[model samples]
Target: MNAFNEISKSTAAFFVQAGASFGVSFLGAIGGIYFLPLDPWQRLFLGMTVLFLVASSFTLAKVIRDQQEASTIRVRLDEARMEKLLAEHNPFSAA
Candidate 1:
């Protein structure tokens, strides 16, 4: 039910490895495009396309994360309301 419980902490080494992998992949793509014997206009278009893809990927990740957070919050709210109702109930009361 806690935010901390939902997220596991990453070790420094793991964090570094992830970052390095991403950097290598992105740079490799760009470097490969740069070395190709194509016209400048073609290279520029490829570079722009790659950048746009990266941007869209980031945006998509953010959207997914936000949706997950929203769902978790909604579940927590519903749980709280149920708990409050349970706490206020009197089983022996006569109506």
Candidate 2:
């Protein structure tokens, strides 16, 4: 079907884009390391430090996102409880 062909094309395009982005980023990192004036050991240390920082940042972001989601869920639950209480208190309600 035409839709299937379109889906396949889009998937291929996504793969190509991802590959290109990775290649560019890899080259840029290599170039940056090569240009640094630090000794080999220092460069290695710095690279490792940068990687650790990046990993930590990703972890921190996930934690923050999870906390936000939990707070949102709590808020919704509170709102639902309040609504139920209000309905129960309404004198005009046909119990």
Candidate 3:
């Protein structure tokens, strides 16, 4: 119900999906390598495989980084807000 919980749930979902996609792509790449003939056309498949692998890796990194950043921001923001509320309510603090 809270912002932090919501963010965590969505971020977890994204990571799961990203991981699944990466796995599928990896399997497909392996299959493609084996099915492609070793002719000039094979170069095309090789290029595509390389590009797919690179792009998938980049995508995975970006998703992980983004989720990490989001989680960090949520934690810091919650901490700041709690600190502010605590400061406001504390009877021991000097005026």
What shift in Å separates residue 29 of candidate 1 from its native position after superposition?
0.5
**Whole-model alpha-carbon lDDT for candidate 2:** 0.77
Q: How accurate locally is residue 11 in candidate 1, as Cα lDDT from 0 to 100? A: 85
Sorting all predicted structures by TM-score, with the top scorer first, yields 1, 2, 3
lDDT of each: 0.91, 0.77, 0.80
Better of 1 and 3 by lDDT: 1
- Residue 90 CA displacement from its true place in model 3, Å: 3.9
Rank the candidate models, highest lDDT first.
1, 3, 2
Best by TM-score: 1
Q: For every candidate structure, what is the RMSD over all alpha carbons to the true structure, in angstroms?
A: 2.1, 8.3, 6.0
- Clashing residue pairs in all predictions, respectively, total 0, 0, 0
Which candidate leads in lDDT? 1
In candidate 1, what are the lDDT values of residues 1-95, reduced to their tens digit?
A: 86745584678899999889989999999999999999999999999999999999889989998898789789989999999999999999997
**Better candidate number, 1 or 3, judged by TM-score:** 1
**In model 1, where do residues sit more than 4 Å from their true spots?**
1-9
Model 2 residue 58 CA deviation (Å) reads: 0.2
Candidate 2 lDDT by residue in tens digits, 7-72:
435476888998798678766776797789989998898788767766797799799978976886
